[model samples]
Target: MSDITLPSTPNKLSRYEITGYILIAAGAIVLFWGIIMFDLVTLIATGANEEVGIVFGEFGEFIGGIVGSLWALAGVFLFFATLTYQKREFELQRIELHKTQKIFQQQNFSTLYISFLNKHNDIINSLTAYDINKSEWSGTNFFVFFQEKVLSSFTQKVRTKEESAKTPELLHSFFKDYFIYHFSFYQTSLNPYLKNLSVLIKLIQRYRAETQDAGEYYSFITKAGFTQSELFLIYHVARYQLLVEFHNIDHAFDVFEDLKDELKVDRIVQQELNDENYL
Candidate 1:
């Protein structure tokens, strides 16, 4: 195979530098023509090889009159040009500083977010609960159990109730009563998890507002390596807006929709997820 090497692209400042060099070269050529070449022309016009002193006097006068004025104008132009160039440099520096601060902010957010996610994972790993039968469940299995067994039963029990939560406020009350109070152990373990999710969501949301990242933060959550069980648990958390009175688990909806395929399997759960209160 033939070697292929493309030339490096020049930056805007380098192009400006090249232009300055060309201007300097042109100015040097003009200076040589005015000072030395013009004196030779004067000598030729006089046709007086012995009258060198008069030619020298005329040369000195020409320099004093024309070249001095040219230098003065050039100096003024150079002064302004220097100011403009310095202004451009300072503007470029300001842009770089803003970018650096933004990158630093994102880095800090990412570190905090990942730490929260790890803490989220840690919370999941930290799960432990006992059902009504005193049967043991832990971690992902516990959520799977809660989703398949507990939440399922609760919906079935509430299905025919005329008072079943149909509004956001009612649903909040419903979740607290049926889920939080009844399954105290689960909610206990779930407290820190929900709290962490709320903080993470708000962090992303605030970042979204400041940076206009536009759904990028949601990608981080979806791709944060959530298990099916963890997503299932989170969906219900958003569904009822659990712990939302104090924090922002409401933003979990962003994560839930990104992983909504998992929510489609159960009809009642699916309907509830699509409910205006939830969606």
Candidate 2:
């Protein structure tokens, strides 16, 4: 048989609240009784005129005064005790409200993070496909290819003296077509990727601002169920994309390093960094 656990019901009244109510009720009853007794003593002292009756009246008045004073003191004590209990209840409610607000904020952050991860995954998938095509290209080889094949070839052709007469026409047509193709490719491929990266960066920045702790933020994200491999992928892709878009590889690397450390995925991140296929 499966074990069944029932949900515990919340208390309608806290101990302090119950005590407060009790004190208030007791105080009111004691005050009322004191008023009645004092009134009775006053009636006796006023209505009686004989010496014996007067003496008895005086005695009753003295005892009534003492009793009334004691009751008043008790009422004052109860009043302050009830006030203290009320203050405590308010403080407890404030604490609970703060906890609820924190939970709400976490839910919001989780939603944003999931959306950001989906976008990041799309870009990562595209890059992975491209990487498969250039499986042998290392960071050094990739840069060399860009310099020699793409940049150098164009520059040399543009600067050639042999084609000086037709240079303007050739340059115009070649550049027009070249730029169109490249721009179209970028628009189709990298634009959405970069936009998603920008959004994720902004979200992380906002979280960091609110938390003021980089380690804690990363830890929270990992604990939210992101695997180490997934985190490594995010770190790797985001770092390189930031480098491509901003030309700030150093800062990108620094940020990824910090994140990996905080996520405690340093071993996985280091292995990827050491891989020859990594850029």
Which digits, one per residue and each the tens of the lDDT, describe model 2 over residues 82-166? 7766676777777677667767877898798887877666564554222335654332232223222322344454556354344
Q: How does each model score on TM-score?
A: 0.60, 0.45
lDDT of 1: 0.62
By lDDT, the best candidate is: 1
- Against the hidden true structure, what lDDT does model 2 obtain? 0.49
Off by over 4 Å in 1: 1-62, 155-185, 215-218, 222-224, 227-229, 245-253, 258-279
Query: lDDT of all predictions, in order shown?
Result: 0.62, 0.49
Instruction: For candidate 1, write residues 151-261 as lDDT tens digits.
Output: 565566556556444654544444445554444646777778767766766776777777766756455653466666666666655554565533345343445554556
Runs off by more than 4 Å, candidate 2: 1-52, 127-188, 211-214, 217-279
